[model samples]
Target: DTAVSQTPKYLVTQMGNDKSIKCEQNLGHDTMYWYKQDSKKFLKIMFSYNNKELIINETVPNRFSPKSPDKAHLNLHINSLELGDSAVYFCASSQGGQGGDTQYFGPGTRLTVL
Candidate 1:
């Protein structure tokens, strides 16, 4: 009975390889987001989707992509993974833009590139 869940909590790979992380939520939220936490512990929003349409897109590389199958699930896919991509990826969701609504985050998927 998890509110949010991310697959392969730990990911280890080499540079130039492709990988993906899956996320799901049972909170019945309409907005989902992807965030990356760097080694310095800087949390930055990468993408946000509402009803399967992209609502927010930060200055992320083209190698990164996000897909929302439904309002309850959002998956992230990365191509040509680079060392710079080694970071903790988080999946979060909110109940829409409800006046500074707080988002719930998953445990996080730690990607380590060699």
Candidate 2:
């Protein structure tokens, strides 16, 4: 079974459109995160939630928002998707603070905005 999974592994859409990406983790981790990877393969943390509560919010654009409905599910919503938003989105989760914080990444959602 996959520890983490993100729906619509690839998303291609035009600018000014709204889109959403869904994610879930079966590992029962307390902390989950959203990460953006650019062409250079640099991964930046976008948001992180612990136990269904927001904990870390990177200084991302207002157009990007993340929601965690439960401990196991976190979804991302983007409004007016811009070309700069064309990057791979990765969903990850960790147990945190117990020597179990090693992040496990999903297959990734590739979003392309034209």
Candidate 3:
């Protein structure tokens, strides 16, 4: 079974549109995170949720929002998507949100904004 999974493996939309990516983890982890990888492959942390509470929220545009309905699910909703939003979004989970804890990553959702 896949420990972590995301819906819509590929997403293509026009600028100014809105979209959402859903993520779920079956590993029973308490902490979940959202990371964005740009075309150059530079990964940056966007948001982190622990036990359904917002923990670490990086400096991202207000257009980007992370919602956690429960411990097992974290969803990313983007509003007014722009060209810069084109990238691969990854969902990850760790046991305690510690630096040394191993993180399990989803396949990633590739978003392309035209």
Error of 1 at 113 (Å): 0.5
Any residue pairs clashing in model 3, and if so which? none
- Candidate 1 lDDT, tens digit per residue, 1-114? 999899989999999999999999999989999999999999999999988889989999989999998989999999999999999999999989457988999999999999
Worst 10 residues of 3 by lDDT: 95-104
**Candidate 1 Cα errors over 4 Å, as ranges:** none
Query: Each prediction's Cα lDDT score?
Result: 0.94, 0.93, 0.97
Off by over 4 Å in 2: 97-100
Output the better candidate (1/3) by TM-score: 3
Candidate topping lDDT: 3
- List the candidate 3 regions with Cα displacement exceeding 4 Å: none
Per residue, candidate 2 scores C-alpha lDDT tens digits across 29-53 of 8889999999899999999999988
lDDT of 3 at 86: 98
Model 2 lDDT, full chain set? 0.93
TM-score of 2: 0.95
- Which whole-number lDDT from 0 to 100 does residue 73 have in model 3? 100
For model 1, the run of ten residues with the poorest summed lDDT: 93-102
